[model samples]
Target: VFRSEPPDDLSSEKDRVRVIVRVRPMNTREVDKGDRPILTCDTETSILVDGPQHSRRFTFDAVFDTNSAQ
Candidate 1:
């Protein structure tokens, strides 16, 4: 979430904004190991706002599965 205030020269009525959200695809990678195999995955969520003090937010999550957590 984000908030913005209009400039001193601008009035509140003239200030408006829009927001856009996107969930990007996850990335997976493989690793080589002599004892066991390792894998990793990550995903990201982005929030973009355009107009009147543009702002953005990004969040990311990561997980590792070793055949134990399915």
Candidate 2:
């Protein structure tokens, strides 16, 4: 499912396409294999990727997580 925010006012906003990021939930197969989720969306505008060696945060126009509604 996909969800979208209302468009911004063209008169006040810059002309640019929004960059959205969506993080899907782990599938049953992956869960069965004991794989854990590494991506997390703590806010509407950023995502965090947790890795073995390092963690990185990416900012975007919008971000959605596994629990986000359409």
Candidate 3:
């Protein structure tokens, strides 16, 4: 999770918070082991985790996938 300060003009909204999720790319080891990516970010604010048994969806204020820039 990441937090940011509102502008001085919006100091009264200090109580607000923002959530962010970043999905990292596969490493060399995982690639060598033939591991497949199970997480997908179809939208800018959501992530989908696909598992063998089931799938789950998560929402956030911002979502970054493997291809996102630093």
> What lDDT does each candidate get?
0.33, 0.79, 0.79
Quote model 2's TM-score. 0.73
Misplaced by over 4 Å in model 2 are 1-14
Tens-digit lDDT track of model 3 for 1-70: 4223224553344666677889999999999999999999968988888989998777777899998877
In model 3, how large is the Cα lDDT of residue 55? 84
Off by over 4 Å in 1: 1-14, 30-70
- In angstroms, how far off is 70's CA in candidate 2? 4.8
RMSD of each: 13.5, 7.3, 6.8
What lDDT is obtained when candidate 2 is compared to the true structure?
0.79
Candidate 1, residue 57: Cα displacement in angstroms equals: 15
Angstrom error of the Cα, residue 9, model 2: value is: 21
TM-score of every model versus the real structure = 0.21, 0.73, 0.74
Ranking by TM-score: 3, 2, 1
**How many pairs collide in each candidate, listed in order?**
0, 0, 0
Candidate 2 lDDT tens digits, 2-23: 3323435534447666788888
